[model samples]
Target: MSTSTIFHRVAFIIGGGSNVGMHVAQKLKTEGYRVAFGSRNPDIATLEQKELFPVSVDASNPESIKSAFDLVRTNLGEPSIVVHNVGIHFQPPVRNDPFSVSSDTFAKSCNIQLALFVAVQETLASFRSDKSTTPKVFIGTGNGLPFLKNMPPFFLALASQKATMYTMMDYASRAYAPEGFRFHYATLVGPDGGLPNLDPSAEVGFYNSGPAHAKAFWNLISADVAKSWDYRFTYAGEPLMT
Candidate 1:
């Protein structure tokens, strides 16, 4: 695969119906990529008007994800870029009590990691089969929870799952680097280089800006392959190896 070859610029974004996912999709569409937004319930009318494709997907279900990928391939060609933006987080029933978390809740939260693994496998298979020179990139959206030593007790399940997800993606980045594929776990932080406020309605700072994340993702995709294997990056697109 060489850069000179012509191929469709297709992107598949999991959990792309709202928030950061929609922002990334819009950015890619503006960059001339055919974008597919995948969620449990897709807003087809809005997506069609934006010239974006919509596919129904349940991130916790591997079969649903596989079907979504198939639909993208059939509608927009093999996606050279795949973004996994789905995650699970919930406050414990008994705040500040880690043990108050139920087994079923923890199991359900961890299942997103399994979904990410399946998405990665599907992306790699698609990349291996495509001969285009476009960058083959898979990005997993993350946050600062994984790095905190004293994580909030209510966030125990989320912290554990994110740490595991980070490890899995880091391994994938190294394992597939020889083949020119890029795997990145983007950790979004506040503008002042601190943890972002997790409240959806919080207007803490610029780090919460969807466009900023979109730009960071675009930068990662446009980076030189030689410098793109760092496995993790900050919201500013700076590599974070440690």
Candidate 2:
């Protein structure tokens, strides 16, 4: 029997209704992984994609997360993978500085990222209940440079959370390695949403971040490994740091 067989494996994705989350879910469905996505509105997943189950989840509320995970567990089996793609982008574009962002908003941002840790714990607990032997994967989509490096002004919440999550993933990657769990943090260059100082035309050849990263993740999980390999990947989905 092959050590890797992804058919019908479950993936619980947070915020998988639209944007990059939608793209990732589409890719995973194509690869034959049963996907249950959590978003505010379950209605976003239409009749077209019958296999994708959408559950209502409020990213900021811990109770909502618990409920969502419980729903996923009851509906589909324990998930073989968990994708933390939830984030609250600052509205109105905060190009200025700290004065622009209120403490309440930052608190919400912190909660958004902190939810991943909670989800990861609950996910593992679910898997452990049945003593599942299948290797599990946790994937977190990140932004900007990790706070350890440089913090972009516009990405205040993102940088702060990304840095902490990076450290969390690093620790989990090591602690869970021997038990056959894999963790990955990927910082992807998203679609040309027409950001400042960037020409949309110049991105003609750039890899589509969502689908590309999804494929990269699937490939990683399919490959046989003694321990968790490559804790991070680049925007181009390259595992090597170059």
Candidate 3:
């Protein structure tokens, strides 16, 4: 990005330490937008010379989240974009039946997702100025009700919470669209074993077909974005795009 384009707009990315969040940050930065990455691990925060700020934030704690936003506002100006992507998936080692699931595990997952939506709204309300500069929120998916098929009904607490947050997000978008806040969600059908513009041949255990699937999924979603429809849960274990 040229010096003239640097800091033209700003974005706040939650869970921006690794993977998709990091890729999002790189994309935004390449486009000349200032970015701030929020995470519990400050040490691993993605770095930029001046346009990126690494903030220590526990997404599950409201106060910590609030403080992180305050720091971002004080340090990076108003961020127009917010991407929320924080979650966990545990196997049998963590699960002990629906009744036996520890409150901490359940609440942590639920609260983090909920807190992200709340934090974004609060941050937008607090940081936005009268002069608009392209505001958008792109949340990572995997919480839709359709993704819960064949699973125990009780296992849906996290999904339920995510659905509620997205519902709230929809309302916020409609209510605040005049103010320039746009909301979007991206759902992943499976893991991203390799990244775009990388050497897949050197990637160990990488599915030879994974990159094709990723590109296809992105293309399908981009087409969805063009048509301006709310992409919802899957049908029969297939993504809505499929």
Candidate 4:
């Protein structure tokens, strides 16, 4: 390959202002890949890298997503890869039991997870061209536990929603592979991996422990990203092909 030949590499990160999304953007920027970081609040998109394009995006809205994609196309051209890091998990709606799960709570959990799914779907549909050497979609999974575990009431809702989203992701990957759209799912289980220390809960001893476990998991995530483009691994289990 000639040095002057542009690789046309770009990564669009949903919820890019904080958490794993920011870390992933940093990693990609370090490797010389163009990064478009999206946040519901545009002010949150912050990074020192000149190549990083921080934009406002509402993951749940199709029009908002299209606008983000359009902006990227105009400024950075079609992204070679897309990473969705938008999902919320808090102790709120404090579930007492499965039987107590409310319709409103369930909808909130599902909506949050489904938003990422819609973003990925729209992104895949917007690929300017199918003729590229590197074309992939990395959808970050917020629920990292195995499929069989009995999660807390709120988490049960979260996990089921993630599973449903992954099912769609699998079909989309299979459906689009012939046309050069590749979809990959990754479970981002951690409390800290280069997110700004804005939340005091993140500094607490108990909250920090989960992320400590997640830190080791990130090593696996690095290896997974490097070793294979498509595969699935439970946060607590061995690697398996998607």
- Candidates in order, TM-scores: namely 0.88, 0.80, 0.68, 0.68
Give a tens-digit lDDT track for model 4, residues 1-242: 23344347777887664545666666676656778888887653244344577778887566787788877767776776677655554334545565366777667776665666667665765564635655455555434433435455555655666676667667776777677555655543323321222355755332233332233224333443343333444323334333
Q: How far is candidate 4 from the true structure (C-alpha RMSD, Å)?
A: 6.7
Error of 2 at 101 (Å): 1.3
Q: What TM-score does candidate 3 reach? A: 0.68
Model 4 residue 83 distance off true place after TM-score fit, in angstroms: 0.6
The alpha-carbon lDDT assigned to residue 149 of candidate 3 equals: 54
What is the lDDT for 24 in model 1? 92
Per-residue lDDT tens digits of candidate 2, residues 1-242? 13243234778888764556777777777777778888887774381356687788987777788899887777776788888876666642457574488888888878876677787788768656535556588877755456234435676666667776677777888887777778777555423311112243554223235555676677666668732333445445545343
Candidate 1 Cα RMSD after full superposition onto the native fold (Å): 4.2
Residue pairs in candidate 1 whose N, alpha carbon or C atoms collide under 3 angstroms: none
Please identify which of the two predictions, 1 or 3, would achieve the higher TM-score against the true structure: 1
State residue 90's C-alpha deviation in candidate 1, in Å. 2.3
Cα distance off (Å), candidate 3, residue 176? 2.2
Lowest summed lDDT over 10 consecutive residues: which window, candidate 3? 189-198
Tens digits of per-residue lDDT for model 1 on 153-176? 787877877777688778989999
Compared with the true structure, the alpha-carbon lDDT of candidate 1 equals: 0.78
lDDT of each: 0.78, 0.66, 0.55, 0.57
Relative to the unseen true structure, what is the C-alpha lDDT of residue 216 in candidate 3, on a scale of 0 to 100? Answer: 28
Q: What ranking emerges by lDDT with the best candidate at the front?
A: 1, 2, 4, 3
